[model samples]
Target: MYKLGFIGMGNMASAIQEGFINSGYIKADEICGFDLSEIATEKAKARGVTPLSDGHEVIRNAEIIFMAVKPQVVEKVVAPLKEDLKGKALVSMVLGYDFAKYETMLDPSTRHLTFMPNTPIAVGEGMILLEDQQTLTDDEYDFIKKAFESAGSVEVLPSHLMGVGGALSGCAPAYIYMVIEALADGAVAQGLPRASAYKLASQTVLGSGKMQLASGLHPGILKDNVTSPAGSTIKGVKALEDGGLRAAFINAIEKSMGK
Candidate 1:
């Protein structure tokens, strides 16, 4: 079995691990995590992973070490594991920190991959972004792709674009949720029961998205088809436009990027 070592047993790590197992790419026993917290270690153990006392042991043992800890702890955790990082693969799930920042703490021989995975991979429908420093051959790239294929729709994004593009897909699920909630709120305001409002809003959103994808038409054109001159939709759409809904989303993204 190909072994993967995770240094942190947080939500993102657990999600990816579960994704791998459920997709049959990797077995649970083939993965391991080293955590100082007893709770974390126990959680990983319950998930069928080998538990270790410290991150160093994971570095020494695992062929592929995932630095899945929080961003602030990454530098500290990686420093101790640097000596053992040689010849092994290191994949990082820590956001904001780049390859150069990590290289300062890793052995030069380590093959490092920066993988940006969102929380949605827990359900197996995630958008994952991979950016790497080392030049990989087509076969090497495909091999890496296979691992992520089990988690989500993986893409090779240019390093420069990662910052801007990540703001969209990385935070898409949350954005979508807020929209769904707002839609439900509108329905509930009109006297629909909360459960019924949610049902209607969720299905409409899902169905509309599927329609756009299946029809392969521009969204504006598709929307135009829905809003006849005398239709109720145009008035509702007018209220949305007047409320600056589009501008609100734009500002939300910009605010997220600032953080």
Candidate 2:
């Protein structure tokens, strides 16, 4: 049997497979999955993932199954697999779901938990948000955690915080991508070449994030360090403040969580 299986082979699913395989946590041949799209199935095959005939086949051939289907269609996709999933560990990437919701969906004997991953997971620097699992044994949970940690940082949070955690980490990448684009545009406005501007902007953001994580310093303190007295950095910071950048991001998160 394959070690891991995916029910959906869309962008997120493909990215997760790439992450796991590249990290050497699991071999490509050890993974199996099924997607309704022929193109997705072909892509999986190209990645050395065993593409099964259907979700039921995936369940039968894999030990751990990742459900990355859309939230709206999750019930439709999983409803028929109740018996097949009896002893399996199912990690769900579908949003707007919690343990309580799953209690009504899967077999009681099936071990499952919510898993929130972002696009950056395709690389080895993503954030993985997992909800504490009540049904899974300690060994089972730790193995899952370690497997994912090989790809990115893993945080197991209480179910209550899963939504916001997902928003902060999962949704923030798009925001950062937008910030990178805007920074590049600003540089281009200052006569820099677009390609060079984008490269610089992207690296700056990456370095800044690494600095904060490595130094364990407050972001405000880091900003202060960069913004010397009457300096250009301070001027740029003032412009961002004037443009309500902070409020915009805060409101964006709130809107994302449907608050």
Candidate 3:
């Protein structure tokens, strides 16, 4: 039996498989996945994942199953496997979907978990948010945490805060990418080559984030440290403030959470 099973072999599911394999946490053979798309299953097979014929087959052969399909079709995908999921831990990566829905759709004895992991997981530098409906045992919880941590940081939050946490961490990579692009564009406007600009801008953001995490200092303080009296950094900071950068980001998160 495979240790991990995926009901969908889309991008997110592929990312998780890559992360786990790259991290040496689990070998590719330990995973089995099934997708309606033949192309997707072929891709999974190329990555050493055992590709199954259907979701029911995956559920039967794997200990832990991840529902990586779209939220709207999740019920349809799992409904037929109600019997196979009994006493198994089923993890869902669908946004805005809750554990109660899965419990009602699947067998009552099925254990459920909701996970929110971003695309960065493919690179082993992602942020993962987790919420479980009190179904995992101590060992099960630790195993799941360690599995995800191989790909990036892991935070287990109250179910009530999953949406907020998902917005902050799950949506953050895109926001950061936008910031990187804007910074690169500004550099290009100043005569820097596009490729060099992207490298510089991305590295700067990456370093700044690492510094913040390592130092445990307030971001405001870190900004202040970089902004010298009448300096270029301060000038850029002023430009951002003038453009309502902070407010724009705050609004973006609120909108993402459907607030």
* Best candidate, lDDT: 2
Worst 10 residues of 1 by lDDT: 132-141
C-alpha TM-scores of all predictions: 0.87, 0.97, 0.96
Clashes of each: 0, 0, 0
Q: Which structure is stronger by TM-score: 1 or 2? A: 2
**Runs in model 3 lying further than 4 Å from the true structure:** none
List the RMSD of every prediction in angstroms. Answer: 2.5, 1.0, 1.2
Deviation of model 1 at 115, angstroms: 1.5
lDDT for each of the candidates?
0.79, 0.91, 0.89
Compared to the true structure, candidate 3 yields what TM-score? 0.96
| Candidate with more favorable, higher TM-score: 1 or 3 | 3
Number of the top TM-score candidate: 2
lDDT of 2 by residue, 67-117 (tens): 989999999999999999998898898998788899899888999888898
Candidate 3 residue-wise lDDT at 34: 93
Encode model 3's per-residue lDDT on 1-259: one tens digit a residue.
9999999999889999999998999999999999989989899999999999888889889989998998788777777788888899888888877766566677778888888998888889879988846576677778888999999999888788989999998888889999999999999999999999999999999899999999999999999998999999999999999999999999999999988
Residue-pair clashes, model 2: 0
Residue 16 deviation, candidate 2, in Å?
Answer: 0.7
